[model samples]
Target: MPSLVPHLAAVIFVSALAACGEPSSQAAKAGPPPRPVLVKTVAYADRVTERSLVGTIRPRVETDLGFRVAGKVARRLVGVGDVVRGGQQLASLDEVDLGLQTEQAEAEARAAAASLRQAEADLVRTESLTSKGYSASASLDRQQAVTEEARGRLLRAERAMTLARNARSYAVLTADADGVVTATSIEPGQVVTAGQAAIRLARTNEKEAVVSIPESLLSLAKGRAAMTLWSNPGTRYEAKLREFAPSADPATRTYLARFSIPAADETVQIGMTATVTIAVPDRERVARLPLSALFNQGTGPAVWTVGTEGRPTLKPVDVAAYEAVEVLIGSGVEDGDRVVALGVSKLDPGQIVRVIEALQF
Candidate 1:
């Protein structure tokens, strides 16, 4: 029995070693093996990149309605928000003073005309007498000069009368374009100076969103494309990059982007805040990977990629922009390359790794 104890102990030790070396057949078949992460290959397409910004809706052009001549405002025909047509009288100044000036000018012009006529008659009489040898030639010449001077005075008086009529015409403040009155400063009986703003007018149904974009990102679009508008279910509106400021603002380091958004519906109003998204052109296709695939090497950006035989390799890449769930790669990688999406920072180059599974293609 003492000799059998050593053999039994040896046999138990060998059996325990075998059991630890090989998994049981039942345990291997009982549960499913851990599957690797699934990855899908990315397809190349012409996708317009978008950058969104908050903006404000304003009129393309606004004008202040003011009187060209000074007078007391006698009538105001339009109020704020009232739609008016071109040349429509928005307000009127007191015409009594202008009318009096016109009357005085007319009287002066009539008197000048009468005096000119009388001088002309006298000149005719003197010239006749001189021809008949009853008057001196010098006397006739003097009368003729007097008649010419009176005629010149009459012409000057007539011009003054016309100017007075024009001044009276200026008393009526008229709209320059068909627009809605946005403001008014004068009511009836209010005295106003020349060029005093009497009303503010803007195009009724024309609107645009003015956005300030960083100068670094503004070169993406030279012109325009479809943009998303914040109004109503986030409707897409066709916007054209009509104008851009030549200079960037020193304080904000941004340039102004003027988008020409067609106001098809009357619902668009001035001063309404808007969100602007400009679509950037896709020039070149580069490698795109998940955010977890990136790791900083203190010098720049780098990513881990699975090489042949499932070994991790460090690949340097230039990052253009960061997307929602992906980082846009500008260079240093080609399409269809396998990238380590997770645990990339924990890996060293040329290290052996077990692929978890395929991820997004």
Candidate 2:
């Protein structure tokens, strides 16, 4: 009876150990709990909106500086990025040709003056002889006509000499206003035609942002805008629409728009990149979500949507625009659809998840 009792006790202990081992194996097979993630219920609303576009800082008034006369360049007094004042000499032409022209004009004037003196002497002699009846009236009339012709020639020569002097002065190209040279197309010994662009000067006082907008977005760019330099984005400057292209570019189909910055800082230089943003009235409602909610599979942009069963289903979304803090979604998830707002990269399609917090708006 004592042996039978020990056997019964061993069987009971072994049964208890087997029961504990079976439950642990089943729990191990079940795996860990669902991963916790932050989620939000998507809802569409008509919100005031703005769009940002990249642009370049440029002068509102860009002038092409050129020589008034065609000649070989003697020297280029300024270079690209050189700050210049009004009436500053930018370049000079070889004065050899201009000098010869001036000398020739002077010589012609001297010859005309000598001819005028001779004609006057002849007219005076002829008048005296005619008064004493020693010369014919016809001869006096001829001398008078000769004297008038010589006077006309002298006047023409003087005017020609003045024009030659002016031409010589024109050989030295000067700035029309205070500006910075943005480009130089001519160098020493380079021959440039009259009115050919030798240097590109941009006025220093007026600054503008030049950007290209697609045809679809041209209507929104009419009113006031904002500008921020690429290097210094924190400092924003108020800008107004100055001008825009009436027609679109054939290749790009984009219209060029220029925005005038009211008071741009000195640090904003020409050719520097900038961003222009303009607000437009929203025509339709859209779902706004934090940027962290976006995920790009091989196909396109998507977001993890949590279903009632706590399973995450990746829903493809059409992103309308990306803002500083949020992304505007045009379509994809409907209203009241729960979407994972954070830690999207860690999730998988149809993976089980637990929402730690629901984000409002």
RMSD of each: 7.5, 9.1
TM-score of every candidate relative to the true structure? 0.68, 0.64
Cα lDDT of model 2 by residue, 123-189, tens digit: 9999999999999999999999999999999999999999999999999999999999999999999
lDDT of 1 by residue, 241-280 (tens): 7778898899998888788787435655676667776667
| Stretches of candidate 1 exceeding 4 Å from the true structure | 1-41, 45-49, 214-227, 246-254, 262-265, 282-284, 287-321, 329-361
lDDT of 1 at 48: 56
lDDT of 2 at 165: 95
* CA lDDT, candidate 1, residue 218: 70
lDDT of each: 0.77, 0.91
lDDT of 2 at 171: 96
